[model samples]
Target: MAEYKPGEMDISVQEKTFDGFISMVTKGAILCILVLIFMALVNA
Candidate 1:
């Protein structure tokens, strides 16, 4: 049976997930703003 200390792995995975989530959210927000600006320019 493979064994690992769950506590350390859990913390590592949680931090990685949080970092990825923040990056994705930031990128999504920027993309949304860019799209909105493009739409506004097109409408103008």
Candidate 2:
């Protein structure tokens, strides 16, 4: 296997971390919206 440079590896790691964080935030936001809608429906 080929070896990666420190700077390149750092950037790759950061990109992956950012992507994962964004994904989790998106999922959490969707879940919150769904829950709010459900609660409103139940109340109405």
Candidate 3:
């Protein structure tokens, strides 16, 4: 196993807030696509 020195202990972890942000963006894009399709169907 590799070890990091005390000052060089660069750390990385999946932040909980990041999950919420990604979910919000994904949901927004899906919602926008659905709305556009609905409009096209109605206009046609």
The per-prediction CA RMSD against the true structure, in angstroms, equals: 3.6, 4.7, 5.7
TM-score of each: 0.76, 0.77, 0.67
Error of 3 at 42 (Å): 0.3
Residue range 1-44, candidate 3, lDDT tens digits: 98757866533445557787899999999999999999999999
Candidate 2 regions exceeding 4 Å error are: 1-10
lDDT of each: 0.91, 0.91, 0.84
Model 2 over residues 1-44: C-alpha lDDT tens digits?
89967765447878899999999999999999999999999999
Predicted candidate 1 versus true structure: per-residue lDDT over 1-44, tens digit per residue: 87877665547878899999999999999999999999999999
Predict model 1's lDDT versus the native. Answer: 0.91
Model 1 clash pairs are none
The ten-residue window of minimal lDDT in model 3 covers 7-16
Identify the runs in model 1 with alpha carbons over 4 angstroms from their true place. 1-10
List residue ranges in candidate 3 displaced over 4 A. Answer: 1-14
